[model samples]
Target: DLDGDGDCEILYGSSDGKVYVMDHLGQELSGWPQSSKADLQGRYGFVVSPSVGDIDGDGALEIVCGTLAGHLYAWELDGSVISGFPQYVGRSAKSVCAVVDIDDADDAAEIIVHGGKSELWAMKGNGTALSGYPLELGGDEDEFDSWIFASSPIVLDLELDGSLQIAVGSTSGEVYVFNTDGSVVDGWPVATGDWVYSTVTPVDLDGDYEPEIVVASADGKVHAWNAAGEVVAGFPVTLDAPVYGSVAAADMTGDGANELVVASSSGAVYMINKDGNFMSGWPTSPSATTFASPIIIDVNNDGALDVVLGAQNSALQAWSRNGELILSQVHEAGDWIDGTAVASDIDKDGLVELVFGAYDGKVYVIDLDTPATDANLAWPAFRGDRVRGADAVSTDSDQDELPDAFEMAQFNGLEQSGADDFDLDGVSNANEWIAGTNAASASDFFSVQLSYLPGEPSASRRVRLTWNGVAGRCYTSWQCGQLDEGEEWELADPESGTIDCESTGEMSHEFDVSADDCFFRISVTR
Candidate 1:
């Protein structure tokens, strides 16, 4: 497409370690070359993926590609090598990702790529890595074993524990889940009928706003698992044939529910709904086997989705949202297509284009160039945002019976649900709650250096501090001023402090505050 025109073009990179610039007709531009002049390498025997991000923050774009040679390369638009080019990943980085901050503190957005075996590494764009080496999900002490590691991991927001998790499928047919903080949650594994070959894809399969992961196994089955890793049904339903490519997720049937698009070695494309219900329609098989994956786009501005897939026969096909045969481009001159990827907005005209990788080690970009309108070129509908496990799930959005952190996340950042009670002083709010004389109103009750508490026996009471919200959170613990490496400020897990739960609502405990103004939070669970 002419950049000055409203039309668009596709841009892609390939397996031979070269990048391609193409015209709308899948025709090479006069100045285009099949291989990059940069002499970059990422040959992992056969694995590669190129990611697009404005690394230099320049208006122009950049490339971050991984290779079977276990190296990651970053290149600028001028075809010159960037300072961060060619970083090691132990051996072959199968996948690369940008870290989504789970703490929600707006930390730096570094790139995270997976090395072969069980290693996960976090690195800066310049390839400067954090202190720790790549960490393994399952240590040698863990009894669990993956059937064997072959599947590329799919990142998902499971655990709903605030952050998104890395969902990995092992050849052993076991699905392993880790917290966004990179720690193991509960141990529950899904036994796919066969080895998992594709990356894990998660969508709100049930449309409850919660997402479910779709894992395609080599045993010719696509299994669905919930956040807990339990097989939703007797999954492992047979697909048309054994799977090698990744399973695609998007609203394919035009229904509100998301559909699973599976591409097979037999070159068949099948669509199944959330319930694993297959559509009555199955498109005819293409002339060549499809090891390359499938992608979705709304090609005709119908507000519906279109399907696109690649084949080793050097064919790239696109189906209309309603399954109508629309566009096909075959490059007789190029090597067999090995991997396919799509990106939108190269021209920023609101429409995205198509890109694919070939065995010739060159990337190809072509204009999706369909009659897609702005309505048809919709971005991902699911824009998930929320990260932090400082508190358990906030069941009472109204700030009722939970901790201040629970209430903090919901309301403008404070709830007097009374979940935190560090002092056991009948009050369980936050640092905002403190009453030197009375322990009941932690929120409204600010602290006063207690000159005295009555030498004689005094009644136990709760001290409540007041913040704008009904509760307060985060306090510098006076009992344990500064925490050491292993120190934690916790009352008692099972014990409810010196006060008895059976003592009725009037029960309270008296604990001395610091001579200086110290911070603390209190909650009333009982």
Candidate 2:
């Protein structure tokens, strides 16, 4: 998936402090198996799953993960570390990171994570901390003992408003909802009366259009709260065992209403209705224990959704919508399956594959026999999607590397050609898309300026070149000694190769003036 080669490539970090990318045939990708110990001095290795997205607005996805050593790292697809990364968060980062577009104006998304004990960290794509972030919690003694531990954060429009909010749980038994600006949503930080290790799942349990925030506690209770932080009418439902994984939702009965799916530590899976009652054939156990979250999909190509889950017993279970076990579809693994499964048509072969990581140090990709359908089912994957963004997957109908959603939103259709300039701004539609510049405005293209450095010695005269750039994009400069026709151009700084932008701002570089007739030009390398 990282190379867009039609076959899905698996990305995972191991206990040995190495992150790897493997193709579908299990061959390692070039420049992979990047070691955190060598790269960031990471001693504790990666304890949480990695998140992928185009964090830098450079049109290519970047992988982001936090080590248990409390250092967050970002790497390009080619195994190179992003500049200014390996940012220290706190004592440790036990939670999964969420990469999302918290601010629409920025185009580049933000990385949100619970930085160990009592701080929620938010950083821009360029590895710089977002303003008013790394928000501290648990200030009052009566509030709680500790804040977020292993629970991942979710970004969604909880109020049914246009703006998104961050929702996460604390080990102290409270669910906090914060606006993009780090301000607490009115009436949030609701008490669940027990420790919460599960990520908050948003589902419209009552057909109200507004999703109800659902979460389970370690004390074997499920709680659903409305937008106003009020408990749902049916109230908290008690389960037989402690819940360690997040709850999932889907229309299991094809009744058009979502049923909450909960997997307990004892491996008991329950389907609960909105009325706080268990559905028929309830509490089915697939294995001895389970700490991984469950996902819903049409595994048999049936119109009704099916349950797919992983367990500590090294088994991946598939159950029908009516609670019947699909014995033939069950897959056994080499070790404990503690990570939630994600489904995607990675091969583009009209069928989806279920992917997950196991304690045996292997990432498994299971091909489901079901044909690919519109993945509109509730809670189809961990934290909602492969990137853990809690948003619908963006499609690229024209396969131009530009998402259809983005193209439609920005240009009204797919009529714009990737290699052609839409606004006659000297930049192609593709480059404009990568730079996050306006495609219809001729004045909004990438621009560069040249000037002489003020403090340079006359004998070593230097010229400074500054250009507006997007973070993570590589820019290369070319120079020609003469302006005559067919004159050869060479790299302005041959030893530097390409310059990687560290932030979406004016980036400057100085070159020793080689000739009075030198002409220079800057272009994006990637």
RMSD per candidate (Å) reads 12.5, 17.0
Against the true structure, whose lDDT is highest? 2
After the best TM-score superposition of candidate 1, give how far the Cα of residue 187 lies from its true spot, in angstroms: 4.4
Q: Per-residue lDDT tens digits of candidate 1, residues 1-526? A: 3333444444454545554545455665444433422213333332444444445444444556555555666665445567976787654555533333233333333455666554666566567775463656432111122222245544445633235556666555566666556665575566766656566766557544355767787878888877777676645557778887777766565455667777777777777776776666654454577666777666545556777777777767766544556644433327676565564555545555555666665556565554433223322111111111111111122323432222322222332344655335554443322222222333334332322344443343233332221121222212333545775555422233433233212222345544332334444321
Cα error, candidate 1, residue 6 (Å): 12
C-alpha lDDT of residue 184 in model 1: 59
* Runs in model 1 lying further than 4 Å from the true structure: 1-12, 19-47, 53-62, 75-85, 96-107, 126-133, 137-155, 159-162, 187-189, 300-303, 320-335, 341-345, 348-352, 360-526
User: Per the 3 Å backbone cut-off, how many clashing residue pairs does candidate 1 have?
Assistant: 48
What's the true lDDT of residue 427 in model 1? Answer: 48
TM-score of each: 0.59, 0.71
Q: Stretches of candidate 2 above 4 Å error? A: 38-42, 139-149, 375-378, 386-526
lDDT of 2 by residue, 1-526 (tens): 6787767677776767777878777889888977774323335677667777778888777888887667788898898999888888876676788878787766677888887655789898878888898887552221221333467888777753346788888767889999989999998999886778899887778753357889999899999998889999886999988888999876677555778888988988898999889998877954578888889887777666788899988988888866888888788899998878878766778777778888887777887777655442334577655332223222232446454333544564456667878789898887786665777789898777999767745555678889787765788888877889999888888888689977778788888766454688877743
Candidate achieving the largest TM-score: 2
Task: Report the alpha-carbon TM-score of model 1 versus the true structure.
Answer: 0.59
Q: Which ten residues in a row have the lowest lDDT in candidate 1?
A: 382-391
TM-score of 2: 0.71
